[model samples]
Target: MTSTVDTVDPAAAEATEVSRVVISLLKGVVYQSESAQVWTLLRRFQARVTDHMTVMGLDLVIDEAEGYAHLRQATFDEANIPRLVPRHRLSFRVSLLLALLRKRLAEFDATSSDTRLIITRDQIAELLRVHLPDSSNEVRLIGDVDTLIGKVDELGFLRQVKGQEATFEVRRIIKAYIDAQWLADFDARLQAYLASMDGDGEPRG
Candidate 1:
């Protein structure tokens, strides 16, 4: 004699899956490569997850081509509701580093066959150093650049390569933030910034 039992409920399982995916997205970005199972569940229950986010005044942003998903706050013009997400004001150094990286990523995409853009800490320092108005204190400048890189990493635009020293992979999500239009005027904007910094006689942050 054999005893067999089936106890799984389809509706409950699906509901649980959606909840899991929603929670994962709420926590932070869910990358297809980093979280394959969650990404699959998200794609499977995208509508459900989006519906849930909408209820919370949030929107689900997914880039299948880039294989990343995250949550954004929905705009409500008239509704007097407290925001679940906080807006962060990035410092000058962090912003500058991000712009440089975005420009580099664009150039890389145009010339290289590889999608992944890996850069070393020294390379990043050199990229920023050339644009700086002051370079008298090499040690201080390098330290400041490292700090800016750390900020970018915290913002999820740069990921450190495991088992590698001072190497990072530029996350493609940066493209979503710095669009094609931004890149079109990048050179002019960069020159303007440099001119302003030179006039100030001191680099700000």
Candidate 2:
């Protein structure tokens, strides 16, 4: 039996890892807490990755302080010759929840000195309850609200605290995705949603 010896080039191996990291970023946001490999690779190769993405009409948005990064389209333009990154369309209710969460986070940051904002499932429900239309079936409404919280959890904005199943730590990186401009638009959307909730007990428009 003959065995072949394969030699891997150090430079080529690193380039491959860097490329993988970049591709992963393209897929979605990369949090330093998610993987040590990705965080190391990103910190090392961010400049190269940014330049490469710039060619594709995408920008690398990195919050080194927060240790999270993601890609966004270079500009909001109607003339789309080709786009590498796709836009995310959130449901009206989800959008409202995110706005509320972001607002709560801001308030937490302003009032408290803690770096992390920890909140329970009940607290989150109460926060949303006021905004939602009155529903006769309390059980159904609470269950639906629980599902909404799961959606936010899946979106990476809220991380379940270690050893605490019912509590979550709100990641500050939310500010990057939902910015002031988006918040300004949120008020109008909220008003429309309230108007739509007149009879249905939930938003229709």
Candidate 3:
């Protein structure tokens, strides 16, 4: 039989895998776009990666079926490692839009026969409008909706479909982060938003 030492260096293999996983997550979310190489690496070394990142106060969120992975700050203690991944503070409107998109994605997953759920700008606008106060300025409302969509796109929850204008693919990470616990109180939250949106057609504290 061949000697194990000649066949593989266990220490070197672990180091290389750790480097690849860390570098990939540092760059941003790892989506299984064209290849599953990273997914394989992540699964094989997930424990080790978790151990390594936990020291820096970060945790990995990975979904095999969704084919994506990202890191989030694991702790908030002042004495801990400085938060490497800064938390994103979303405005109220932005938060509402994200919730709406996440709800739509859930609906699509339940009702659609197609494997993918893609929506046009108009569809998203229609979905949001029902929750908003009636506005006389239709154009301005649409523009605002477009701006919100752009913000979602920037946050990586919404992706513009290639070769299609005014269309987007709702990335699955939204569901991963927005848990069922959040959805459980979603209705009451929306009602509170409606209450907060003062009669002047603006949402305010």
Candidate 4:
């Protein structure tokens, strides 16, 4: 007995497959190449899907220099009531590190490109160590610094550059997150914090 399979149009089947793949990929955190693939698949569709996504309160942020993209919640308008997402509370150390990194970036922007922006691990340690309480526990201090570094890395504010355990790229995204207004408001507090650190004996050399 011969069996006959039901016939389906090849083009229709391909289109259906592409649609499914694109939708699955857009579930969360889409990058530029992924977005491009989605655009390719949905171009034939009537809806402006990207615009629709924006209307739904998501902003597609693309960093061409970094070659990455991700969706973020759009800032709420004063006219509309606020909607809150679960906030990630950073520790004091992490906050200090972020501020310092932003300040470093500002310094780089002011200086000429001919001068390389270089900050050593020791300098970072020194900058932070004073803020922390003085304890004979050397291991504990090192662990704290490591934890702070890990936190920054997770937030995409710092990228590990070449060299084992040394050197990191302070991502440009930091400037966006830590804006001028916040820095200006915190300047006096930061100055006091640094002065307090200076009052204490210098951090381990």
lDDT of each: 0.85, 0.79, 0.82, 0.60
Q: Choose 1 or 4, whichever is better by TM-score.
A: 1
TM agreement with the true structure for every prediction: 0.88, 0.77, 0.84, 0.57
- Tens digits of per-residue lDDT for model 1, 2-55: 999989999999999998998898888899998999999999999999999999
Off by over 4 Å in 1: 1-6, 134-139, 198-205
* lDDT minimum window of 10 residues, candidate 1: 196-205
Error of 2 at 67 (Å): 2.4
Error of 2 at 29 (Å): 1.7
Preferred candidate (TM-score higher): 1 or 3: 1
Candidates, ranked, TM-score: 1, 3, 2, 4
TM-score for candidate 4, residues paired by index: 0.57
The total number of steric clashes, by the backbone 3 Å criterion, in model 1 comes to: 0
Q: List the candidate 3 regions with Cα displacement exceeding 4 Å.
A: 1-14, 33-35, 76-80, 137-139, 199-201
Give the distance in Å from residue 117's predicted Cα in candidate 1 to where it truly belongs.
Answer: 0.9
Q: Model 4 off-target regions past 4 Å? A: 1-52, 62-70, 76-86, 114-118, 130-143, 191-205
C-alpha lDDT (0 to 100) for residue 64 of candidate 3: 73
Model 1, position 1, has a per-residue lDDT of 100
